[model samples]
Target: MAFLELHNIHKSYFLGKEEFPVLNGIDLDFELGEFVSILGESGGGKSTLMNIIGGLDRNFEGEVRADGQLLDHKKEKQLDDYRRGTIGYIYQSYNLISHLNIVDNVLVSLNMTNLNNREKKDRAIELLKQVGLGDQLKKHPNQLSGGQKQRVAIARALASNPRVIIADEPTGALDSKNTAEVLEILEKIAAEGKLVITVTHSQDVANYGTRIVRLADGKIEDDTRLKPAYKTTVEQPNVKPKVLSAGASYKNAFQHLSYNFWRNSLIMLGTAIGLFAVLLFSGIGNGVNAFIQDQINSMINPNSITVMKNPAGKKMSTAKFEQSMSQFANDPSKLLLTDKEVNHLQNLKHVDKVEPGYQLSTYTLSYNSKNANGSGFQTWTKAYASDTVKTGHAPKANQIVLDKAQAATLTSTKKYKQLLGKKVKLTLPWIDKNNHPVQVTAELTVVGFTNGGQTGAITGTNYSTMRHLLSNAKADTQANFVSVNVNNSKNVKSVAKKITSIKDNGKYTFGAITVGDMLDTVNQYVSIASIVLAAIAGISLVVSALMIIVTMYMSVSERTKEIGILRALGERKKDIRRLFTAESVLIGLFSAALALVLAYAASLGLNHVLYSIVKFNMVQITPGNIIFTVVAAIAISFIAALLPARKASRLNPIDALSAD
Candidate 1:
């Protein structure tokens, strides 16, 4: 039994079903320590036979046995493994990857070995130095002469330490001196107990080997032994090969991206612009919502919910309850809450206290014969934040807190503080106990100023003080609204729900409104606006994805020959597909990183400008936004790369190796 055997190999090409046979029935036996040359003219079967031995051409009628193990051509994976572990190929063109340096080109094969990265690199350098291109390891293929290129190819082939080395016209493009050096290298390789096969048409080249087989028109014309085979010597252990892992594919993809970064950066910039827009708008929406909540929370107690009489007699949302406020204005009697409802609210769970108060729509403040019209005048309760009183104490008995504007209306804007200690006549029309309108008047001392929130300028007095004045005027002073203060801010919503659930005869009696409900209504509108703007910005991402798709297709077209070389190097279809997809995803990853930086920078600039007017940051990017940007970039790139990568993966190794 021989080290390798070929039995009756036959191969053909078809011109639209018209058969053109390339190889006839062939039988051969090869062993270690032999430099066998297959010499033939152009259009003969020398290269075709080499392809069969190298496992690149499997659609043939034959069986190949490597050390008596039948090579199964029917199993694609088996053939890939056979080529990866058992065979090394040297081509006349020295098909090195253009983007990779000489050492990197060799490492492409070493990456599949079980050796560690440091070990693989050390061996690659060792192999390059052995081939006498030690100083040229950093050089690309274009920097080298024809012979140097061939030497790099030889180093790459030997990197994986395959058992048999197949050279297809290895020295066809070299001068006589380079050819002699290459042949000597081959002779040394054979002496180390490895089978070396060279396909050549040169008679002199054939004569340098241990044995010569001449082929004329696909049939062996003669078999001649020039000299006895070299003595087989003890060889070092070969590197154990493994299937290409996903990590190596991504690493290679990263190298290629780095090699062409300037071009890829343009695509990344385009993608980053879109991501930045989305990130910025989302941040702005977040900040806007936060600012609104902050401002509202500063003026009103979030732990207190304002309960109003349910004029419509049903459970209502904050918005719906707000819509019914105008009807209460038409008939103020209906707005008054009964004593029973106010007492019920105080008994609810989480309720700290329930303060019942009256809200007067029309009123007049008279001081020093200066009169100003006022509205939204209500009795002070726990619902108003103490901070809302910008200056002075809360209104005491016979005292009223006038908002700055109303105080300014009665006096000069600069001297409104002077009116704080002065007495003012407050008069308003109110409903009697019989639902008939009557006039109410009081002399209340102005004690403080406020910056009213939600409702403009509010004038407030104590509940007992207002009740006393109304009773003196023979007018109804029933509480129109009640503030249900919760024990904890977190329980505000639950208390509001409980209040809204309080019913009479299957009809909700009171409508409740909390600070959170108002903030939510404002936030809902802000979110819709931001989302619409972000969607408009997303148009650019679609364009960016299209650019990536076009660029990947161009890469597949440009790297078609490289794809073929990788396939010939024993890479599987999925690995080849992964190469392109991985590169695209890296592009996306970098683009997202760029977008984060962009969004942050833009936020800083815009916030600086907005802070001057609003006294707060207007854009705030969150962790969720960062994650979304990164994920979006990767998903778009992966989707964009699918078709191009698939096309690259499906090319025939033999046909691809021949591509110009």
Candidate 2:
């Protein structure tokens, strides 16, 4: 039994429906320690036979039996293993990966073994030294001479220590002197108990081998035994190729990406800008919402709901009812809350207390001939008691608390404090039931001044004081509006909803408004604006994804031969896909990092510029936002690379190797 047996091999090529036979009825036997040369013309099928024997072209009808086991060419994994562990190929073109150095080129084949990184490196270095290019180990293929490049190719082929060595036109491009040097190396390789098969057109090259088989028109014409075969001193070890792991794939990906750093960086910059815009806008929205919430909290009590007439009914339109309420001083009966309604509100669920308040449409105050016009007056509620009192105390019965602006208007700024305890005459205007103008006057002492920057020209007094004045003037004492206080701030919304559902005789409904409701409305608007802005920013990410797709496709096209080299070196299709996918993920990671840094810097600059106006940081980047940005970047990039990576993984090894 021979080491390798090719039994009646038949192969052909097809152009549309036309078939061109390349190898017809070829039978050959090979053994270890034999240097066999297949001499032929250009179209005599020597290269085709070499390709089949090397496990590169499996589209043929043949029984390739290695050590008595019939090779199943239909199984891709078996073919890959044969190429990785059983055969080594040397091409005339010196098909070396341009980005890798000479030593690294040899290591590309050694990487298929189970050797450690250091061992692989040492093996690659030793192989390069064996080929007489030890000093040029770090030089790229383009930096070497033609002979040197061929030497590197030979070193790479021998790195795996395969049993079969297939050389196609090994010295085709070299001078006589370099050809002799290469021939000597091939003779030595055969002497080491390995099968050396050289395919060539030169008779001088065929004479170097121990046996020569000449082919003419795809048929063997002559077979000659020139010399006895050399036997090895030691037995050859059986070694299998190791599967490429994810870590190894990523390492190769990083090397490729680093070699094209500037191009990848530009793509990353484009993606980072999009991510930065989205993150920055989202942060701004958060900050704006917080600012509005802070302002609302300072202005109103969170646990209080303001109640008003619903002004909506089947007979009357809401607009018409609102108009009537605005003219309440003319027709006080339109929407005034009666005592019965006030008591009903006070007994509702979650109700702590109901404060009845009256607003007289118009009033005037005379303090020592200093006349001050007032819009309306309200009785102090628990909500109002929380206000900051700049001078004196809250208003009691027969006393009034004036706003700071109104107080400043009635006296000099320095004398405003002096007016706190002074007596003032207040006159209330009204239309009598019989359509007559009337006025009610009362003497009240100034009790306090409120920090009323939020509300203007409003006077606060006790409920009993307003009720007494109204009764003295024979006027309606119905409360204009009531404030419903909830037991807990969290219950404000539920309680407010219940209050709004309260109806008087099924004819009139009430309206409920809580500070939380107002804050929610403000936040809702801010959220909408933020979503719109972020969505607009998100368009850039789509464009960035497209850019990545284009870039990956270009990379696949550029590295077509590299893909072939890796496939020939026993890398799996999944390993090829992982290489490209890993590169894309690295790009995404870099983009996310750059975007986060840029967003942080932008937030700093924006906050620094807006701090004086808003008195707060206007941009807030949360941990969730940062994480979301990073994940989004990676997902987008991975999706973008899917098609390109698949294309690379599915490339034909033969076609890729033939590509320029």
Candidate 3:
């Protein structure tokens, strides 16, 4: 039994069912401490035999044995292990990764071992020093001369410390002096009790080895032996190559990404723009909804529901009802709430009070010969008692409240405050059941000033005083709308729903409106608008994802030979996939971080401008939106890279190494 054996190997190639024999039946044996050269011509099958022996080509008829155990080339994992732990290859082209420095090129092989990072670095440095290029360890491949690049290739092959070394035209591209230097190194390697097999066409190169086997037309023509000039000295290490880890894959990904920083940054910027638009729009929607709710709360009591007569059996949407309300604004009779309905609403759950209110479409107010005409008036209810009054008290019986603007018109600016105690006469108009125009008059004291309404000229009067004046003047006194108060603001929604469910004679349903209901409608519209804007923004993300896919595929094409180098160095397909995926995730993370910063800055500027007018922050970016943006970015990038990464991982090492 020998250290390595090839028993009666037979191999051939086929061109569409036509057999073209490459290697004829040949038997060979190899052992430690032997420098063997398979010298041959261009089509003599020397390289093909070396490929089979090096575990790179498995499609052949052969019985390969290492230390008497058969090498099964059909098992991919076994072939991978054999290539990683048993053989090292040196190519004529140097085949160095251009992006990595000299030290990193060697480390790319050494990383497959279980050695720690410091140990790997030290080993790489020591190997580079052995090839007499220690000072150039930090330089990239393009910075090196032809001889120096070959030296780096030799150093990289030796870094993994395999048992057998295979050199295919290793010195083919070098001058005589450099060729002699490379041969000397190979002789020394064989002297250290390791198998050194060199495949070459030069007889001068073959003479350096202890044995020469000449091949002519795929058959062995001669086998000759010579006296060796060197002896064994160094001992081989008992280390085995370990699987690459996820952390190492990511580290390699970061290195590759950093090498092309500007290109990757542009992709990140495109993705960040989309994420920023989505986040900013979502924040603005949230803020706008909040602002509307605040305004509603300030203007009307949250615990109050406005009740109106529903003329139809079916309910209408808020938008449709609002349109109808505007169209029927002049016909107050269509929206009148009967006295029986008010009594029914007062009997409902959570109902603390029901105040029937009259809305006089047109009215006039007179005080001390200063009269304001075409003024609107409403009966003051408990729900409007607090915020509507700026001074004095809410209107009761013969008392009335006027807004500050209206009071200012009836008196001098200095006397407007004093007008709170003055007596004012109100004239109201309505049509009776007989369709006749009627005017109602009442004299009342100015009790308070209203904070808001249709206009400051509008006045608030007691429901009782308006009803009494209408009765004396033979005018209809049916309430236009009623206010139903609940015990708690939180129950407003449920209470309003109950009020709408209330029906008269099983035909006429009542419509109930609370601050929450109106706010919900407003928020629904805002949410739809936000989603539309965000979707429009998402188109950029889709485009960015396509950019990432194109970039990854380009990277794969650019690094095809590097991929072969890694695959020959024992990296698994999954490791290759993970490497590319990690780079994409890093791009996504960078985009998300940039988008978050931009969104925050935009929010600050927008809120500053909006606050000057509405006194409110109108762009609120929440934590949930930030988190969603980041997650969405990462997911999109990862999905986009899947196909390219898989294509990269599936590349054949032989085909990739052979690519120009």
* N/CA/C clash count, model 1: 0
Residue 14 lDDT in model 2?
99
lDDT of 1 by residue, 139-209 (tens): 98899999999999998988898889999999999999999999999999888878899999998999999
Of 2 and 3, which scores higher on TM-score? 3
Angstrom error at residue 59, model 3: 4.0
Q: Can you write out model 2's per-residue Cα lDDT over 520-620, one digit (the tens) per residue?
A: 77788999999999999999999999999999999999999999888877788888899898999889999999999999999999999999876889899
Determine which window of 10 residues in candidate 2 has minimal summed lDDT.
313-322
Q: What would the TM-score be for candidate 2 when compared with the true structure?
A: 0.80
Give the per-residue lDDT of model 3 (tens digit) for 1-660: 368999888899999999999998878888878899999999999988988898878888979987777999888788788877788888899988887899988888888887888989998999899998989978999999878888998888888888788998999999988999999988888887778999999999999999999988878899898865345667666456877788888888888899899989999999899999999999998898888777666656778888877766456765565566665466667777677777888788888989998877778778778877755577877656366576778888888888777787788666788887788888778867665677788788898876553223547788898888788888787887898899988888888778777665676467777777788888999999989988998999899999999999998998898888787777778888998999998899999999999999999999999889878999999999999999999999899999999999999888888888
Q: Judged by lDDT against the true structure, how good is candidate 1?
A: 0.90
- Give TM per candidate: 0.94, 0.80, 0.82
Task: Estimate every model's Cα lDDT from 0 to 1.
Answer: 0.90, 0.84, 0.84
Worst 10 residues of 3 by lDDT: 450-459
Score candidate 1 by TM-score against the native.
0.94
Task: Flag clash pairs in model 1.
Answer: none
